[model samples]
Target: MLVHHLYSGGKDSSLAAWVLTRLGYEVELVTVTFGLLDNWRFARETAKRLGFKHRVLKLPVEVLESAVETAIRDGHPNNAIQFIHEKALEALASMPDVVRVSDGTRRDDRVPFLDLPKARSLEDRFNVAYIRPLLGLGYKTIRELTERLFIVEIRESEELQKADYEVELRHLLRERGIDPLEIFPKRHYQSRVLGWKSL
Candidate 1:
C-alpha cells in the first residue's frame, strides 16, 4: 500500500520515517505547517537526508475550532494538539496516494485514542490506514533509535520553543496529568508488522 509518514521533524517522527522506509514500503514524508508560520525545516531536512518524498500542508489555527470543540467535549486536555492532527489529516485527505498516514506514536499513546469510540480503523477514515512504526518504543527508545541511526540536526527553531501555542498547551496538559502526546497514533493494530527504517 502507498504510505505517507507524518513528519514532525522531531525525534519521534523522524525515527518513524526512517523505520517506514527501511521496511521497503513506498512511503512519503508529509509535514503540516501550522499557520504557514512554522516552516518545519527539520522535517524537510530529514526527508532530504533520507531521500523520501516530502510533502507539506499549511493549516490555520482557527480552522481547527470544531475539532477543538469536539476534543474538549470529550474532555481531552490537549484539545489543541488533537485539533492540529485533525487539521493535518484533513489536509492529507486531499492529496494523492494517501492510503496510509504513518505516525510516530509509541506504546503509551495507544491507550486513549485506540480505545476511544472514535477510534476506527484507518481505512474507515482516510481511505488510508494510520501506521505507527515506533508504537513498541517509548520516548527514550525513540531517542536511542535516533542516536543509533546517527540522525543529525533535527532540532526545532528557538522561535518554536516558546511560539508553538499547541505545544505549550500540551505542556500545561502534561502538568495536569493529561500527557497529550500519549494520544498520538501508533502501529499496533492488526496488520503485517514491517520495519521501514531508511537510514
Candidate 2:
C-alpha cells in the first residue's frame, strides 16, 4: 500500500501525494537529486510538514551531464527536462520495493510528462503502476485545491529553491558559463509548499 511519490516540494506534486494518501495509499515523498546541489533538503522539509516519509535518491551524474548537453544542443530545456523526468520515473520503478510510482504531472503540463506509451512501457517492463493523481486536474483546479489544503510560497523559478530538475539543470548550465535564462523561459513561476492549512 506504500506508493513512492516523485516529490519536488511544489504545490502540484505535494497535492498529488496528499491525494494519494486520501485514496488509502501510504505515500512516501521521494526526491531525486543529481548531487549537483542540496536543494533536495527543501523537499525533505515540505515532506516533514506533510507528515510523509521522505528520502533522497541520487541519480548518475552522467545523466545530468547529458541533459545539459541536450539543452544546449536544442536551444531549450523542454525535451531535456522531459528526459530527466522519464529517467527518474524509470529509476523509481526499478527500485527494490517500488511497486507503484507517481508523479505530479498535470493536464496542462508540457514538460516532465509521461505519455501513454512511456507509462505503459514502464509499467510493462517493471511490473509497476504508474500513477498520476493530478493528471486529470487542470491548473485552476490544482491551484484551488492547494490553496485550500496547504500554505504555498510562489516566486520566479530562478529565485525559488525547490527540488525540481530544472533547478539542477540551471545550476549546471550556469557552472558551464551558459546562462540558464537564455534557454529557459522568462517569467516562469515556481511554488514551494510551506505547510498545511487547517480547516
State which candidate has the highest lDDT: 2
- Candidate 1: the clashing residue pairs are 18-197, 19-196, 19-197, 20-196, 21-196, 22-196, 22-197, 23-195, 23-196, 99-128
TM-score of each: 0.64, 0.98
lDDT of 1: 0.56
Report the C-alpha lDDT of model 2 over 63-147, residue by residue, as the tens digit.
9999999999999999999999989999999999999999999999899887899889999999999999998899899989999
**TM-score (C-alpha) between model 1 and the true structure:** 0.64
lDDT of each: 0.56, 0.94
Tens-digit lDDT track of model 1 for 36-138: 3454555576567666787776666455444444544566535555556655665676467566777766777632224333335344666666676877787
Off by over 4 Å in 2: none
- The number of clashing residue pairs in each candidate reads 10, 0
